[model samples]
Target: MVLGALGVCALVLGWRALDLQVLQHDFLARQGDLRNLRTEPLAAHRGVITDRANRPLAVSTPVTTLWANPREVLAAREQWVKLSNNPVLNSRTLSQRVEANAGREFIYLARHLAPEQAQQVLDLRVPGIYALTEYRRYYPAGEVTSHLVGFTNIDDVGQEGIELSMDNRLRGTPGRKKVVRDLHGRVIQDIAVLEEAHPGSNVTLSIDLRLQYLAYRELLAAVTRNRAAGGSAVVLDARTGEVLAMVNQPAYNPNNRSGVQTAALRNRAITDVFEPGSTIKPLTVAAALESGLVSVNSTVDTRPGTIRVANKTIRDHRNYGVIDITTVLTKSSNVGTTKLALAMEDHALPAFMEHFGLGTATGIPFPGESDGMLPIRSRWRDIETAALSYGYGVSVTALQLARAYAVIANGGIKVPLSLEKVDQPPQGERIISAEHASALVSMLETVISAEGTARRAKVPGYRVAGKTGTVHKLTAAGYADDRYVALFAGIAPAEDPRIVTVVVVDDPQGQDYYGGLVAAPVFGSIMAGVLRTLNIEPEQPVGTYAGVIDREGRL
Candidate 1:
């Protein structure tokens, strides 16, 4: 009976071996392969961001991330301890992580290390340690282009600015490949790639690095010299409506944002809004001209330099008695603008401003772009209308103000603004009659004359047409008497407009808080550089000002 039982046991064991090896062969083989074979991600390089001239603004650099199988690392004991010697890896933290993830097969040991640095760790020959290739974003222009080009996160995802707006286009798809690993979880054999990685497509922005540098330098100097809170400047190709340069003061370096203030990260030119002050006068005059209620030759009486609207009293710098419409804008007269606004039909002014791109988005591909507030009321109050005329009761960003001037520069056409390079000039909607636009440009030229408010805004060889604005910053207690926003918006080579620029210096301290004193000089300096950089020919002799009134009021 013992012999029979032993023989039966051997038969049963043979049958079980056959069943295991033959019946479940594929399933068992798959389970075994799962332990040794793995699918690894192949990092894709992000696209290059460049200026219109193809200068690199942002690029990606190769990096290495070191990872290890926690179980293997803990098992290696002494071998793992050697890794703690590297400065980037904390000994206690590493030990804690490995111990906590003791059952896991993978954990990051060090991320985004330079290849040379990662090689030093690999040379130690730890059993479970391995390196994976990755890419990190690098800004070539640093803080100069930080506000616009933006920065990305450690995972190569865009976090702000253009990087965030165009993320999907800039971040390419990651590929995958199969690899065989040893028991310690180290890659041992190369396997076939399941997919190939495609690098992201390049982005070409309308920004001119040369002009960007010019704008950045000048804006920084003005902000520092004036001891201002912050500022923004925008330069646009008037004919094409493409942004040549856009910069903000209090900029933060995107490459290294260790302790950057949250406020410094904002692209203020497009994101922040303020009452445009006297900068809106030119638009107000345009509205009046379009309404046929006023003419360039028409005059408004300024008697005692102040006027009453409801419970508010509007005042100019001083009493000039009476002034023409052109003089109204040249002087940035609140009384004159109020007269113009009060004479027009309530809806007329707002409708005209809307046509000029106020209260609307410029359609530029940027994150956090604010469409400035243009109030709509079923019934208009005299005070509201007057305030709207002189650039209150409404708000605008520096970019929107630049675009409004571009309409007059582009001969009444309102072209869509573009952040990217434009191969062709875009079609534009006609906001005003070209005749009226030309007439307005001619009137604005007087503002840069010797006797006008923005005399300092003049470029030596070109006829500049612009307006000056100094607005009391509105606070919770109402308009702050001590704080001001100095602004200058202009078109260069006014006869044949090429570029439109707007400079906004907020809360300028000291006695020089007026737009003509603070912002106009910045406008002149930047416009001069831009005009020369574009190789635009001079329209007149450098020192000559024919047909322009002299400081003595003599033509």
Candidate 2:
């Protein structure tokens, strides 16, 4: 009786254990499905970028991807051979195919497949082969807008320029849906809704396509004429801080990105910095006049063209005698600007620099703004101060120089530079008195006259105030070669300034490498085209543009 009772208990325990193990299998499988299932990141379409006129600069286009699950491919080896012959794949040998197909149960055959190629693969119905939907960023303007629109990586991430800066807003969220598959590996009814992605917002830039083309053409011509290593140009609306056009040459093809790292691909206008040379003279003169150190008629003792200060001999490009402060700028006299800068407290200069947006990013909203160097006043020597007066011992990006001119063009108010559309204009701080600014404008107008250096910069229908600069390129050790950076920074229609431009030709090699010849003509050509494109009525009256600069080079 005791043995029978023990056997019965053992049987009951055995039966209970089997029931618990088998009956709980369903719960374990559900937990596994929760842990193992996942959704991969899919890049949502990037928004289109258009010029102010709503012409496409960049747009996202539909593309397809080629993928394969080797395990699912039950096709004969010969059929696999035919599919591998695709030019995109370029598999010549069976060994290559085996090596490529080795190890991975699933592999991506190609990304960004052309529609035709993808369709061909689909028609073949090559079992394991599949096509995935994707999108690609395309610059419809082609090389015309590459520098501004920029290109994305294969992963559709913006890498530079406006693309990088506005990437977060331009790259939309992605969506996913979970579904159960049949034994044949086909998607069935939706098991779960993973997420829905929001599309990226469109970006509208301040650039006008017509002006952009003009600027690009002029810059290209300047580079070719000067035999320069590279060049950059920018045009800004003086009344409004709108950037109409910008170009940095030795550019790249965004559509084909294999050689994107070329040195010229860099945006010299906003990214690179250099000693501004005499292009900065107008600012110093403006500062002097604003501080009441001198008037436009103030006579600076610039006799002898050279002066010794703090163990350094400060010399001009050439000497001038007893020139007024205005002539000092007209002739770009280094000694005169030095004397004027010396009269002001050394520390007060930084205030002007700050107002003009030098030594700081202009915040133009492009990527890689170089905050050019400006040392403390206390660290300056007499020679350094003199150098600073003539735009040396200081480095400033091209955009910064344009900003300074913008302040003068705007009648002493220095507004922040902008790239996007603004419903309401931004306010600016007063940097100089309006009278002083007008005085400076009068001086700059002389720069484009026959008696001045930049004779090529004259606009027949308008008065232009501008400055010319030529500086030696710096090497690791010091300034090297006769390779110079020739530049002109100008404002048009000084009576009612409307646009500010800065043009620089890097390492110009021809006889016409001086700013007067190399860069000034470019400014003229660009302004002429842009003015007509924007329908900016010539201040000089109809047919006056042709006479802006007479055949004899007299203003």
lDDT of 2 by residue, 260-302 (tens): 6768568888888888899988888887877888876779888
Model 1 RMSD in Å is 4.9
Cand. 2 TM to true fold: 0.87
> What TM-score goes with each of the models?
0.91, 0.87
Which residues of candidate 2, in runs, are more than 4 Å off? 1-43, 74-78, 88-105, 178-194, 317-319, 545-555
lDDT of each: 0.90, 0.79
Best by lDDT: 1
lDDT of 1 at 208: 98
Residue-wise C-alpha lDDT for candidate 1, range 295-395, written one tens digit per residue? 77899998799999899889988997888988898778899999999999978888889888899888888999999999998988899999999998889
Top TM-score hit? 1
Query: What 10-residue stretch in candidate 1 is worst by lDDT?
Result: 546-555
Give the Cα-based TM-score of candidate 1 against the true structure. Answer: 0.91
